[model samples]
Target: MSKLKLDLIKNSISYFREAVAYAQRDELDETRWKFAIINVVQAMELAFKEKLRRIHPALIYSSVDERTDTVSLKKALNRLVDPGIGGLVIAEKDPRKIETAVKLRNELTHFECEHEHEHMEAKFADIFSFMIFFYREHLGLETEEFIDYDEHQRIIGLVKARAELRTRARSYIKAENFIDVWICPSCDESTFVAQNGECCFCHHKEAVIECASCGQETLESNVIDTSNYLDWDYDEGRMVLMEDYGMEMTACQGCIETFKSKVEDMRQAQYYEYMEREAMSYSR
Candidate 1:
C-alpha cells in the first residue's frame, strides 16, 4: 500500500481506540474494559500496523452470525444507527459512497496481494470514501444541549474530504467475475482472465461473452476484462457467480482493453442502485 493509504487506516484505528476509551465507565471494573480493548486491538494489530482500510465492514468486524441476520454493508451500517443500538460504533454516509467504499476498501485491505492491487489502485483510490468511527456510547449529551455543531462540523468536514478523495481516485471496473482458470492452447499453462473465456497466451475459447469496450463478441473463461452480463447464482442463501462477462478464445491486448471498458459500465450501475436505496431511506 502507498504511504497515504496506510496513513488513513492507521489514523482511523487510532481514532477507534480513543473512542472506545472515551466511552469507558469509571464505576465499572477496569479489567473488563482493559481485556475488551486488548482482544479487539490484537485482532486489528496487523490491520493497524498495515493500516487496514477494508471495504467490507463485515470482514473487518468479523463478528459473524451463523443463524441470524446477514446483509450488505449499507444495510448493516443502517442497523447500527438504529436508536436502539446506541452503543455500536459505526459510520453513516451517503449509501452510494458506503457501498463503493466497501469494494474499494476490500481491494485495499484484503485483495492487495492477489487482485491486481498495484494495477487497479489508481482507480480504486478515487472510489475510496471515509468511514468515521462514531461511538454507540454518546458523550452523555442530550439532543438540544448535547450535540455540538462544532464537533459535528469537524467530523463532517473530515468525512467530506475523505469521500471526495475517494471519488476523485475511484475507477469503475467490474472484474469480480474475471477470476478463472483456463488452459492455454499454445503454452498449455493455466492462465486466468478477467472478462471472457479464453486462454492466457494463445487465447482459445472456453466460453463466449460480449466485449463492452468495442461492442465485439468473445469467449468466456479467458483472461479478458470484466465487462458484460454476469452469471449470478444463489448458494447457501447468497449470490455466487457461474460465469465471467468478458473473454475470448484468443488472448490479445485489444480483448483485455475491451474487458476493462465494460467494468466501468457495471460500476455505474452499482452506484445507481446504492443511491436508490439512500433515496428510499430519506423518504422513510
Candidate 2:
C-alpha cells in the first residue's frame, strides 16, 4: 500500500511540475500534463490488478479497446471474482483527486489550455496517509487528537491541513465548528468535529449550534444550552461583542462551523506570491 501510494504521488508530482511550468508560461498544454497523469492512473489500475490477482487468479483482462479512452478502470477492478478485497479501491484514491487528474487529462486530450490554476489541487492535496493509516495503524492518533472520522476522511483532513499549513492552523481549523468538516472552502482548512449544532460562533441566527472553539470534544448527542452565549447576540445586524471572541472562536460546539477555506484569502494571495518567488528560485 505504501509503495503504491508513493508511486502514485511521485507520478502525480511529475505531472504537477509539468502543469505548473505551463502555467508559468501562461500556456497550458493539458495534453502534455494529462498524458503524464494518465500514466499514474494506469499505475493505479495496475496496482489494483496485481492486488486482485493475489486474492484470485480468475480475474482476466484484454488489451484496451481502440475506442475506449481507458479513463475508468472498472474492467480491471471487477476482474477479480472474490469479494474479499473490499469496496472499490478507486474510492480510496478519492474521486475528487481522480477528477483532478482526469480533468487535466481531458483538457490536454480535448481542449488546449483550460486549467484555471497554475497547478493541480490534488498535487498539493497532501500525502494524507499520515493522518489516515499511519496515525491510527502506526502512531494511534485516535479521537483523542481530534474528532471521529473514518481513517480515510481523517487522512483527507490532515493532508489538507498540512498542505495549506501557511494559511491554516490546526488551531484555526478547530476554530471552525462544523460537523464532520472533511473540507473547508473558505481558507482551505479542515477539521474533525465530534458534536454538531451551531457554528463556532453562536451568533448565527438561522442555525444555532454549540461547538467548542478549543479542544477536540463533541458528543454524538451532546446537548448545550443555547442561552449560554448572551454576550454575542446580534445587535440589529452587528455582532455585539462583550467578552473574549476567542472563546467563541475557540471552543465552538456548533454544527458545520468553519470560517475560512484552506487559507484565508489574503493569506492565500500571499502564498501565491511566495510560490511565485520560490518557482523563480527553482529556475535560478
Candidate 3:
C-alpha cells in the first residue's frame, strides 16, 4: 500500500476511536452527536474501502476510471457483500443497518436536525456495536484497545438483551424452519438460518442454486439459468432434433459467460458456412 492509503487506514481507525468517545460522552450537544454518527459511518466506509484496496484496488471505485471524489459509501458497502456484483463477502452483516446510519448522516449533513438526545444516543450505541463487530471480525483489528471498557460491556449487555428477546419471540412462534441446522457458506459454521430473505448469522442471504454443468450447489446469485431450451443432436453428418429432450442447464456465471462465447463463435462459423453454400448455389 502507498503512504496515502496507509494514512487513510490509520485516519479511519482514529475516526472510529473518536466516535466511540463521542458515544461514551456523559452529555453531548446535538451538533457533536451528529458529528459522531457521521464519523462512525465514515469510519466504516473507509475501513471497508481499505479492505477492498488490499483485495483489489479497483474495488474501491465504482468504475475502472472512477475518481477519488466519486467513491461512494453505497458502492463501497456493495463491494464488501453484494455477491451478484462481485462482493468479497467480508463484513457479512445487516447492510440495511449501515445504510440507515448513512441515511442519518446524509440528513444531518443537509439539514439542521434536532431530535431527542436519547434516540440519538441509542442510535450511536447501535452503530458502536456494529463498528466493534466489523473491526474485530472483518478488519481483523483488535478492538480491546480501541473500545472503551465500560462502553464495551454496555454494548454487550444490549446485544444479550436483544438476543434474549428474540429467543423468547422464537419460542412463541414455534417455527422449526427458523432454526439453524446447516453450516453457513460465508462463516462456515452451524449458525446459518434464514427468515424471509436474510440470513440469521451473517445476514448474507439464502440463495441456493445447483449448477447443471458441474452439478455443484452454489449461491443463486452466482449462477445463471438460461430459459428452458432444446438441443439438437448430430447423427451421421445430419442435424436431428431430439423431441423428448427436456433438460435445462443452469451454469455458474463464469461458466455461462464462457458457454455463451463459445456459442457465439459456433454461430459465426455456421453463418459463414451458410454464406459459402449460398455462393456455390448462385454460381451453379
Candidate 4:
C-alpha cells in the first residue's frame, strides 16, 4: 500500500471518530446530528476506497477528461470481494448498513425531512460496528482504544435503547413466541437474541438461567427476585434477595412460597413441643 492510501485511511478514521462524537452529543442540535450522518458515510466511503487502493490503485478511480473520478462506494465494495483483488475481503460484512448510511446521507444533504434523533442513533449503531470491524480486519487496528471509553459506551447504550423501542413496536416479531424473546439487559434489544449463547451485535453472552423449581431456561432477571426464605447465616429469618449458588437454595416464586410456609409450620411445631414439655415438667 502506498503511503498516500495509508494517509487516506488515517483521515477516514479521524472523520469516523468525529462522526461518533457528534452523534453522541445532545440531539437537540440538529446540525450536529446531520453532520454525524454525513461524516459517517464519508468515512466509510474513504475507508473503502483506501482498501481498494491498497489492492490496486486503479480500483479506486477512473481517468475522465484528464481529471480523476473516484469510483462509487458501492462499486468499490463490490470490487473488494473479487478473489483476484486479494487484499482484504470484507466477506462477512453486511452491505445493507453501508447502503443505508449512504442513502441517509443523500437524503439529509438534498432534502428536508425530520431526522429523528432516535432513528439516527439506531442507524449509527449499525455503522459503528461496521467501521470497527472494517478497521480491525483490514487495518489491524483496535479503533475503540482511540476514543473515550465511557462516552463511547454511553452512545452505544443510547443506540441500542432506540433499536429496542423499534423492535418492540414490531408486532410481527412479538407474535413468534412470547417467552422466546427478551429485551437484552445489556444492549436492551431483541437484536441481542443469541443462538449460540452469544449476542451478535454487542458480543455479550445471553444471560440465561434455569428456574430452580420449573427447570426452564429464562432470562436471568426474570428468575431473580426477593424471597422470604432466609439464609442460614442470618440470626433471624428475614426476607432477602437470593439467586442460584448465592445461598444454599433458590427457588422460583411458587416454590419459594411453599418453602417459606413449610418453615413456618416447622417452627410452630417446635413451639408446641416446648410448651408440652413445660406442662409435663410442671405436673411432675
Candidate 5:
C-alpha cells in the first residue's frame, strides 16, 4: 500500500477507537459526547476516502483532473453509492440517518446547537452500529482488529438501548392515535406527526405544506415548484404565457410523475396533428 493509504487506515482506526472510548465512559458529559460524535464522523470520512482510494487513487479528489482538494463526505457518499463505480449498497433509511449525523457533526463543530442528551445518544448509537458493520464487512477487518471484545459488547449495549428507546416512542405515538406519524428525517424515528409539524421523539420541527396537485401533506422541502415548467411564447418584444399542461404550481413526487406523463401525451398529440396538416398540404 502507498504511504497515503496506510496513513488513512491508521488514522481512521485511531479516530474510531477514540469515539468508542468516549461512548463507553460511565460519566459522559456534554464535552465527552461531543468528542465522541466528532471523532466518529472523522473516522467515517477517512474510511470512506480510504475505500475510494482503493478503488482509484484519484477517486478521493474533488476533481479527478485538477486534484486540488479532497472530496467532501457528501460527494464521497454519492460516489460510493454509484453502481458503476463503488457499487456499495447502503440501506435506504440509513442514508437519511447518515445525513442527519453529518449535519449534527457540522453544527456541533462549527456552530452552537442544543440537542437533548437522549437524541444525541441515539444518533451516536446509529452511527456506531453502522460503522462497525462497515469496518467488518466493507473494509474486511476482523472483530479484534478494530475493536476489543469488551468494547464490542459495550457498543452492542448502546445500540440495544437506542432500539428500545425507538420502540417506546413508537408505542407512545400509536397509543395517542397520532394519525399523521411519519419517519423523522432528523432522528430516523417514526414519530414526526404531520399535524403538529414536529417530531415527538426528537422535537425536530419542519415546515409542512399541502401538495397543490394531490392535496396530501408533505415536507415543504420535498415539494417541487412546477412554475418553471410553464410554456411561454415570445411574441413581438414580450413573452406571453402559453400553456401549463394542466399542472399545478406545486406538486408532490407522485403528481410530478403524472404531470410529466400528461405533458408527453400532449406533445405526441401535437406532433401527430402537425404531421397530418403537412400531409394535407403536400396532397393539395
Candidate 6:
C-alpha cells in the first residue's frame, strides 16, 4: 500500500477508537456525545476516501481532472455504490442511516442544535453498528483488531436497545392506524404520524395546521404566513389596506408560489390606482 493509503487507514482507525471511547463513557453527557459523533463521522469519511483511493487515487478527488480537493462523504458513498465505478454494495437502509449520522455530525460541528438524549444515543448506536460491519467486511479487519471484546458487547447492547425502541414504536403506530406516517425530524425514525403531528418514537410534537389558501393540512413550520409578506405601513405600525388578503391568510409549501403571485398582483393594482389619482390631481 502507498504511504498515503496507510496514513488514511491509520487515521480512520484512530478516530474510530476515539469515538468509541467517548460513546462508551459512563456519564455520556452532551459534550461526550457531540465528540463521539464528530469523531465517528470523520472515521467513516476517511475510510471512504481510503477505499476510493484503493480503487483509483483520482477517484478520491471531487473532480478527477482538477484533483484540487477530496470528495465529500456523500460523493464517496455515491461513487462506492455506483456499479460502473467502485462496485461496493451497501445495505439498503445503510445509506439513510449514514445520511442521518452525517447530518448530526454537521449540526454538532458547524451549528447549535438540541436533540433529546435517548434519540441521540439511538442515532449513535445505529451508526456504530453499521461502522463495525463496514470495518470488518469492507476494510478487511478482524473483530478483535478494532474493538475489544467487552466494549463490543456494550455496543451490541446499545444497538439492541435502539432496535427494541423502534419495534415498540412501530407496534403502537400500527395499532393506532395512522394514515400518514412520516420520518421523525427529531429522531430520524419512521414513526412520526402526520395526523397526530407527533413522533411515536421520540414523542416529539409539532403543530399541524390547515393551510388557509389551499385547505390542506401540513406542519405549521411548512406554512408561510401571508401576513408577513403583506406591505407594512411603518408610520401607522400596521399592514397596508388590501381588500381580500387578510392577516389570517397562510399558504403551505405547495401553494406558496400562487400566494406570492396574488400578493404581487394586489401590489401592482394599488400602484396603478395611486398613479391614476396623481394624474387626476395634476389635471385640476
**Best candidate according to TM-score:** 5
lDDT of 5 by residue, 1-284 (tens): 58998899889999999999998777546676787888998999999999999899999999999998999999999999999889999888878888889999999999888877767777888888889888888888887888899998988987887778778878988888989887776788888988889887778789988889888888776688776666778899988768777767788875888867777788788789999999999999
lDDT of 2 by residue, 148-193 (tens): 3453364356445545653453555456544454332112223323
Candidate 5 deviant stretches above 4 angstroms: 22-28, 115-118, 176-178, 232-242, 267-284
Residues forming the 10-long window of minimal summed lDDT in candidate 4 = 239-248
lDDT of 4 by residue, 55-167 (tens): 76777875424337888887777777667764445534366566766787899999998765655665677677677777778766675643567867876686677566665
RMSD of each: 19.8, 23.7, 11.3, 21.4, 3.4, 6.9
Score each candidate by Cα lDDT. Answer: 0.39, 0.40, 0.64, 0.66, 0.85, 0.83
TM-score of 6: 0.72
Comparing 3 with 5 on lDDT, the higher-scoring candidate is 5
- The alpha-carbon deviation from the true structure for residue 210 of candidate 6, after best TM-score superposition, in angstroms, is 4.6
Question: Per-residue lDDT for 243 in model 6?
Answer: 50
Clashing residue pairs in candidate 4 are: none
Runs in model 3 with CA error above 4 Å? 66-70, 84-93, 148-151, 154-284
At residue 41, what lDDT does model 1 achieve? 32
lDDT of candidate 6 over 74-144, digit per residue (tens):
99999999999988888887888889889988988898888777767767887788788888888899988
Candidate 1 C-alpha lDDT tens digits along 139-256 = 2213223224564454345446545543432221122334444333322334424355544433434555555444554444333534234556889998776644453323334466
Q: Which stretches of candidate 2 lie over 4 Å from their true place?
A: 1-36, 57-71, 74-96, 117-121, 124-284
lDDT of 1 at 135: 18
Please tell me which predicted candidate would have the highest lDDT against the true structure: 5
- Specify the poorest-scoring 10-residue window by lDDT in model 3: 180-189
Cα-based lDDT at residue 93, candidate 5? 81
